[model samples]
Target: MSGNTARRPLRADALRNYERILAAAQGAFAAHGASASLEEIARQAGVGSATLHRHFPSRRSLLEVVFHDRVEALCAKAQERAEENEPGAALFSWLGDLNAYAAASRGLVASLLHDGRDTDLLQQNDSCKTMITTAADELLRRARQAGAVRPGVHTEDLLTLVSAISLATEHPDDEQAGRLLDIAIHGIRLHQHQRAATNRETPARFSE
Candidate 1:
């Protein structure tokens, strides 16, 4: 038998390594916040630290990649939800999922948000932020039209829900997020009730 050995493709291994690194980094960031070490990332990924450096070069670079990937995913999800027939349901579903997505990003989001506007990834067109907002707005509008969600529900409030969830999910319990979301949704729906009570507390005054 001729002992001819075919060279295994580095591309396949490289791709696999990249995927593993991302998975490990994501878990590490969520578990330990943004300051988690690259060594630990490599350990979780089963790759040497040298391999991590080879792919990411620097911590900031890896962070930017993670943030960019998360934003793109959110945009895609928004688009998919918008295409659904029920806009309000799509909006709520996407809003809930987006919080999950952002929560998953953990430290990555904080880094990206703190970046200056001049940063490439933070530029207006670079991040899919506008597109996602637009998609979300359309969904909210349709839901309002259908009388499914509260009227005069601005997109910003739905946005606040995602941000709230992101901040609230720091605790480990997975159900904490859903509870936070429910609280937000309930507040939005009962906003008028709150305002009415506030008005009632104020004395009726007439200038004669």
Candidate 2:
């Protein structure tokens, strides 16, 4: 899921064009929100309008590809962080990455959702939504198993939490994002002593 499954193998020349289009599109979206000109994108990619449309028939199609690539990159980062010795540290770091991605993706994702089919691409099989959800599930499972996270914290909760952070920190020079992340981490975590106390309390009540 992390490896960009949205595209199949391409011939060398075709692949070049594909990569060029993606690169150009990414830059354009970053610079001009999601409504950037497709003609300008073709120009930047050094390809014709026909070539661009051949690869991505519509603006929504191109946006889906770009978002897929970005999600793939984030999935890669989540995989890397999952291997760290400290489960809590790894989860927090990945959460920070998620927040950053969400913040940058604000406008672009909105545009995609405006068009129904493009939005479906993200939620459909083998799409970015699946990739991100799988990664978050794995990371959360690991953190909980390591006794760092509280029981019953779902992957959706983590994503939703970060999404809210991104929205709240949309303005320039906002420091609340990091502070909220810290708060979220603490909220989801179970201190060792807290777990031990809970265990003791449960047994005592059952024994009585």
Candidate 3:
């Protein structure tokens, strides 16, 4: 999932070609999303189609490699933020960062989320999803323990909300994504005054 872990090691020249192909694919996916032209990626990598195919047998395979390290890096950032910032601030900041990443990456994350028949690819996607969920769970747990988050808030709900925002934004931009994330974070955090106000504003139910 994270690279060529299941295969034999590449020879030096093959490794060079593999790296070039991966770089090219990354750029192309970033620029053009999941449906970027494979031929164009091969051309950009200065490799023949046969060589490109030799390195990556499928588009899904190429995409997995291109975004795997990026997801890992985001998880790593979560760890750093947890260590460096207060629980509430770290959770909100990491969500903002994740929103920005999802927006900027265009459709790559969606591609990974797409349900496919490939058994191996499905497993890899599940792994990525698990990694993200685990990272979020830890942050959310910290925030709850610190009384920064409301009780009963699940990591799955937060992730789903973020994914929805990223998908709804017309253009992939940090400003828009950050704004939406801020709104969501405000909604997620515990606000005793707000809750009290809402309780007071509710009319008494008719006795029945």
For every model shown, what is its TM-score relative to the native structure?
0.67, 0.75, 0.70
lDDT of each: 0.68, 0.79, 0.78
- Please write out the lDDT profile of model 1 over residues 1-208, one tens digit for every residue: 0012232455878878977997788777666656678999999999999999987898766666665555666777877877874765677788788778767765544644555432454453443577668767777777766656654568877887687677867656658887788777765552556556544563344111
User: Which residues of candidate 1, in runs, are more than 4 Å off?
Assistant: 1-10, 106-128, 168-172, 186-208
lDDT of 2 at 102: 81
Pairs that clash in candidate 1: none
2 against 3, candidate with superior lDDT = 2
Best-performing candidate as measured by lDDT? 2
**Residue ranges of candidate 3 with Cα displaced over 4 Å:** 1-4, 7-20, 42-54, 109-124, 172-174, 191-208
lDDT of 3 by residue, 110-176 (tens): 4444543333654656767777899999999999778687656789889999988988894655677
Every candidate's CA RMSD = 10.0, 4.2, 6.0
Which candidate do you rate higher for TM-score, 1 or 2?
Answer: 2
